[model samples]
Target: MILCSSTPHSSPETQPSGLYSWPNVFHVPKFTYEAEFELQQRNIEFETNGTYFNPGPKLKGNLLDGLAQEMMKYTNYPKDYQCEEVAAALTRAHPCLGQLGSKTGFWGWKQSLKYKMQNYRTKLRRLGHPEIRVNSLKHKREGQGKAAANIKKARKAEVNYIPLHPKGETIESLENERIALLSEVKKRDNEVLIKAKMENTFYLRRLEIVEQRPMIGEFKNRWPALFEESEVNAEFLRITTKPLQSKFMSQFDQFSDKLIHILKKKGGVKGQRIKNVLAIKDLCDDIDTRRECILKSVAIYLNEDPDSFFKEYLASATEDAERDISSTVMGIYIIRIDRNREPEDVGVVIEGLKVLKNVGSIILGFIMLFGLIYALDLSFPENFKYTFKFCQKIVMNLDGHKLNTKIQQLKIKLFA
Candidate 1:
């Protein structure tokens, strides 16, 4: 096997308090029915309270092997931290499985799972599995020695980041499916077929993304269907197993009232500026306007100019309008489609390219664009980094555990 680094890779520290204490949308993975049946046959007694399960103490080798096999269905290369998370989840579900006298209570299981996963990968490598075979020693570079560079693994809670293709489908065949999808997407009433083809070619798409690292524009051109609003939502769901727009909007609405109240009470120049932004006539009359105000308030609270984050231009302006908008890493480009009235259409620009156009509302545009960022593994723009970070860490509760000082202080005030 191509051994990457012997050293355990460091992950973000889990925050112990503040908004980090909020519950996540991610439910712990449960044991398969077969596994649960075997446990029951082994006379393991357990209690189930909602989604949580508590089972008997002693688990044998066969059980661990089974669990590892199940995990391999999701990812062949589970990172060390992911293993720890699984072990933690396991102990949480089955308190009896906790290792005696261990600090986190599942240290032994974590180590055992790590080894089991390695052995499992070895078996697959021997069987010529494409995913595992790619990581064999023969594929290693001549001068890399024992440690491989640029390890590729899921960064966040991507459950299906690098999944295997469906049975009886090879990489070339999947590529052909992907190629056919390009034309299928252009036709109307083809949603079902398009979605099916997209799902079938997921492995191939991920391989190209992870290996080639194509630019946003290039990738969109090759996989035009993936950029459609529906496909973007579908892709995000496939990766994270959560409905992107619903979760984002629900959280935004849940906290917007409280956050607005908090922002309105600020004392200094920033407070005055936010007050002015909020004072816009009838700002609260429309949901979209209120959401836009909230976004502006958030930027001000974080000491960023909201205008820089959202640029507006006339549709009839010079041809250079799009060129100017493309300079930013990511932003909402409000286009005045009709000079006779308010701008009704907006475009979401990412990586100096317009990814989505004619977005109906500012809040929806932001949420959809943010979903695309997560789905495409794109970095948050530096200008609005904290703003987006706040959304990711707080609203979505994906990696909220570790908060920087600024956001942590804000969290304290918001929750205070």
Candidate 2:
């Protein structure tokens, strides 16, 4: 159930079994994993929401991160999420605590990805393409479409629903075609966007009357007939020759339509000062549905520490390699799981093998075709090597909760 905000305030999505009074308790062991997965989902929502408050300077990297996390932590939040002493210290350290400057241009690539994808979606919506969506031109559309269909199918299957594939056809071919369509759309959209970016830069110059004055004034002095003429494009050139106008491409609709009218009427208007820019959360929306599968994967691995022959499970694999490994893992793992097979029965295993007979003969054959990369080899980049080390450190710290006290002290000192 969705807890929508629009109605007469819908309740939270989970209707408690209400057998016992403890609302925090998980009725199913897997439900606890869902709670952890919510951490990432909530973080995405909170980040988008934070863009609502203020896009200020002066807020430390860690402080901004903390505020985002805290906002997600409590549905209702206190003013000073930091303790009294720490809050006092922070203010004393930077006397003008609430003061801020312009939006710090989006930072870290890790953080940049969420916002960039949001920006991409917003630009599309502004261009009146709200009905359709695509990530980027870099992928194949038919392939993405097919994968999306299969993912939807699998999710439905999780709800105890099974799909009947087309007569004499397999799900695999459908997945590939769907993926190809999505990729094609993504490429076409981006090709158009590049042109829009260049056009936006030229359009922005019309914002400043004084800056535009010199160019329009020169035209009036020289070819007054042309400046006075009804040709809109010619007059627009005079308006946009100004050197000081800023390129704020996000407001292209208002900018373009207004410019066309002004050019036609030989009139001008001043640019308005912006008070807010609402956070766009489209990328976050796409990932929201995937949270269920991610949580399931996390839960299965958390307790069991899954075993397998190949050692390239999760060792900071390169993205290019990760793609191949992910496919190989998907194909192999699904084959291994044999979900339809009952315990103490090999019949389903035989049936599945029979169905898969013409596909890659063995796991090793599939891995070889995919060109599996040894994740721990010297070929791994330094950053990925460090990432593995960092994960190891975190795991070590998790094994000792006392390490959290040290972490707390480090955070306090860093914030101070």
In model 2, the runs with Cα more than 4 Å from the true position are: 1-177, 182-406
lDDT of each: 0.71, 0.25
**Candidate 1 residue runs with Cα over 4 Å from true position:** 1-148, 281-284, 337-341, 411-416
Clashes of each: 1, 20
Candidate 1 Cα RMSD after full superposition onto the native fold (Å): 9.3
Residue 9 error, candidate 1, Å: 28
Report the lDDT tens digits of candidate 2 across residue range 55-166. Answer: 2333333343332222222111112211222233322322333223424222231242233334444464355331112222322245664412322111100110111123
Worst 10 residues of 2 by lDDT: 270-279
- Candidate 1 lDDT by residue in tens digits, 1-416: 11111112122132110111112221233345665565444334434422323343444555566557545545667666657766776665555465666898789888988888888878877987655655667755576444245555555556566555567998789889988998998899999999999988877887777656789899999899987788888988877667788898888888888898899998799999999888762534777778888878988999888888788777787477768876778888887766545666787888888889877887778888888876787678788888888888788776565687888888888777
lDDT for position 346 in model 2: 11
Best by TM-score: 1
Output the lDDT of residue 192, model 2. Answer: 45
